[model samples]
Target: MPEQKAADATPRRLPPGGGHRGGGWMNAGMPAERSMNFGPSARRLLGRLRPQRLHLVAVITLAVVSVALSVIGPKILGHATDIIFTGVIGRQLPAGSTAEQAVEGARAAGNDNFADMLARMDVVPGTGIDVAALARVLLLALALFLVASLLLWWQGWLLTGVVQRTVRRLRADVEDKINRLPLPYFDRQPRGELLSRVTNDIDNISQTLQQTLSQLLTSLLTVLGVVVMMFVISPLLAWVALVAVPLSVVVTQQIAKRSQRQFIAQWTHTGELNAQIEEAFTGHELVKVFGRQREVEAAFHAKNEELFRASYGAQFISGIIMPAMMFIGNLSYVVIAVVGGLRVASGTMSLGDVQAFIQYSRQFTQPLTQVAAMANLLQSGVASAERVFAVLDADEQTPDPAEPARVTRPRGRVAFEHVSFRYAPDTPLIEDLSLVAEPGHTVAIVGPTGAGKTTLVNLIMRFYELDAGRITLDGVDVTTLRRDDLRGRVGMVLQDTWLFNGTIRENIAYGRPDATEEEIMAATRATFVDRFVRSLPDGYDTVIDAEGSNVSAGEKQLITIARAFLAEPSLLILDEATSSVDTRTEVLLQRAMAALRSDRTSFVIAHRLSTIRDADLILMMEQGRIVEQGSHRDLLAARGAYHRLYQAQFSQPVADDATLEPASVAT
Candidate 1:
């Protein structure tokens, strides 16, 4: 192989979203290495919930009502405490004495402050505890709390529906984006990395929303409601309790800034590690064949370690916020308690009011702590959202023509007219190449690996648009036709056969879901699939596993051929289609293909020279250009590139007029 050819054949592994196809992995470093913009990612993630705005409003309204009711419960309980205290003091006074007499008695004892506090208590002298009033106040407090609990539960229920619906729409958008992305986008992205974005990252976003959204909303509302209630009970105590607000904000901000980066790194490493694991499992047999298990394990360990480090760093850094916030809150609580106690003792405030203030202080700090704890989850979720957004924002392939041309009576006469294309701008793969495959002709393309043989077929399918020229099917430009319209008339069988986890019959009928039983049987028989399928205990109903490990490689190939045959396309593409089958199976497939190609134009990419001896046209390509073209005998008579390739394969020279018989090529 030429140097360029060898380079093309080498498998290039890239980090997630590393480089474009022809640009190679060296063109740019790993995308995961870059730092994420936390603000924008978080905002965009919240935007996904916009569709559920009405539900969110309902949730917020419920939370506000619930928090308001909860706040009033503490105040109502404080009022009940005042009533009980007044009743106790009244019972202690002399029977039949007026409240003024009790206050004057305390003042006469040199306890003027106690007299002043007693004067404010509104106790009726000579009375026992007001049992009816106490019962009424307690009942009111209980009812308020019960209503609050019900409202809180309803709010949580609404928030759950909102979060799930938002995440569902996001998942749908990601799926649609993946389908619209160009083939080259997938080529640049590792299968595992892509899967992580679609599965793991999206799942993380869902979990983040589920865990944080309702709790954050409720916490914030509770904080606001508590502040107001504290002020109502005692403005001095409320101000003292709020001293921790700035400190808590500073702590959360500092910790979140550091942890967000680690969270991004953590998810990025997660994706990279998943890619390695997927690669290892998918190619375990290859690793064992080459005795590279140790190397594979080492690579896996390196990736795993990176993931562990990122996760540990993210957790450790974000973990500091809750404890730090709690410390500040505790300090504020102690100060407020001391101040409120002094005021109560000095007779400037009631004991019941001081008690309620303490309760409000605790309520204030608890939500702050809860919010601090949720910081980690929020950071992690936004990191995942950034990754999912990357997929949604990727550039898609050019859209099909607005007014698509139709192929009413298909004849499959594909023509490449001065077509020029490359995977990357700087590295040209095919330049100004042209070819014509007439209807009902079989064109065989033979070349060394990376000689643009596959690229030629890919162009006809319009998998990638031509950089400078146009291709046509039946004298109509393919670009003008809708991609679906063009592909529907074409059937392709690749070297690596793919079978979904389903029955063999379902796999055969994949290309034509509405295929009749007789039509399906005819296709299977024509492609030699029935011969082996009938031998299985389940016959056509035999199930192929996810990896298709249940059947032999040749059997898989036969099933794929049968699938293509069932489609009965006007244009057929067989790319090393018989390379996996045995010699006997190859002969049968060749005969079947010959019959299938009777009136349809077919392009066969093959390495075996014998396969193309009967082809209507033989193309010898080298370095993205056709070096020779003609019938096999004509190419041999010309003593050109085709002749040399044929001679090299057989290891024997041939005379100009020598007739080479077609023989089954061993896989």
Candidate 2:
């Protein structure tokens, strides 16, 4: 919670080059308010901007007109004041002045009469402030103001619509990439860290669009318009406004640099904190059983403290930007005031012009402050953008080939021909090992803890590519087939089955999205989960808590097995699949596995020797090699590695079942 703000705020600075792990060189750029630090790269945000072009064009057009009207409003008021002192009021009209001039003269007379009634009046020479003139000028200004407001409102509405659409696409794309990302990607990142990148980072960008972009755009346009007005009013004085520009720029650059560093730290710290929280929660049971509560708490406290410090540091630096800008803006106002007043007093510039100049100065500063405020958001947005871009930029594995050869759904004949593998370059997990599972065959893999039993299943699934060999299904190389197509034909019931936060029916239905309720129940009966499920309050509709925490471990396994049964894949994989429940559940799972394997190519890796005693081919693996292979009865007769392993597992007295955990139970 202490880091919530930083985690939520969206930092703009990222490790340069979107480093996969180690931080890299950072490019210097403005703090995030206006657009991305790099103008061209920032244009990417503008790509989405075009969708609201009509509304945005109206908004900008109104802004320009409003600024022009405000800049001239003061001049009109000053001119009317001066006119009261001229022939319109004090001086009689020249003998043959035109009738229109006479009418203006009459209006001035009325204004002077009203002015005299109100004692404090130093009128200028040509204000033209008669009732009709006054009404016309005020109405014009009001119209312009209303137009500006309407445009801004419309633009805001447009921005919200765009934010929702952009975030939706960004999140979906990131999630899809995560799913397809090579497994090596996960080896380099914590899951929590990647989650922060895809979720928190994208959310930050959305917040920026909602709150900060308007300020940035307005400030920029104001500065531009006011600069033109300043030049028209008084060339020499216009230079003074320009002077503040550079000063503001330099200070902003420094602020941006410091803030970027803090933001990067904040993001990094937030990711670390989330990582700690997830890890701690995942292992909470382990901590309690081992009585390590104090240790875990102390570690969490340390991470929490770091998170608070990082957040506070990031916020403090970003917060200073607005006030500093305001101070500089106020200083510019003072300079413009003094210089314009002197020009008017010397008669070098008209009073009306000086008045306009002063209004222009304030207009320029307001946007300057806006641009400044925008810097904070700009910084934060760029940070989020960079992270999001980094993910999109990741060198994804070579995509599946286009125009790949196609065949009907697989008939489940698998072969590994001289297949050799290693996770890292120097370490081999499997070497030159060839095996096959023709249809309707049960191949069981037995090995010591470090043996590559699981690796074989992964390769068969093509989760990792083969090295120095080829794997084929029905004589078609797996690599030649579409990844989804290949995997769809394979169904795996991994040891740690994950259940979504949904009902029993939904979870079973997930394996085959179109499965009917009757089919789901049939799967449940096949997997021996129906009796227990029927006893639950809502049967199949019962809501599971986070990670199926509401259910007992045995029950979760049964439901998971039922899901696999529902899938009815051509190739079935049991990767120590029953290693996390009681003996009763283990027996149910074995029966379920038996029923499902009847008409498929099943690859099961077994820990309990009893489970694989009837396997068609039992292979004993040591390190990465298959040292022996045969039927269970055949291996037992050979009395080699498989024989010794089987004897060691089963020779124990049945009494040891009380002390030893069941085959379905795991850490």
Best by lDDT: 1
Q: Model 2, stretches more than 4 Å misplaced?
A: 1-132, 407-409, 652-667
Q: Model 1, 146-227: lDDT tens per residue? A: 9999999998888889988888899898888887887667766766777888999999999999999888888999999999
What's the CA error at residue 86 for candidate 1, in Å?
Answer: 2.9
Candidate 2: Cα lDDT at 441: 91
**Stretch of 10 with least lDDT, candidate 2:** 1-10
Instruction: List, residue by residue over 1-667, the lDDT tens digit for candidate 2.
Output: 1111111111222333131221111111112222235444456755656666776676566556655655555556555444343325423334544534555564577754333322222333343345666567567656756666666666566656766776777788788887777755554454556677777888887887767665666667677777887897788988988888888888888887777766665666565555556666776798799998887777667666766775787678777877887888888888888887766545466555666677777777777777777776776676667667767777676678797766565678889999998766666678899988888899998877657777778787776777789999988888888888888888877677688888888888887999887888899998878988888899889998767888888788778788888988999988767777788778867777887899999998887888888788888887678899999888889977776666556675564544433321221
lDDT of each: 0.84, 0.69
TM, every model = 0.93, 0.83
Q: Which regions in candidate 1 have their CA more than 4 angstroms from the true location?
A: 1-31, 126-128, 652-667
Number of backbone-clashing residue pairs for each candidate, in the order shown: 0, 20
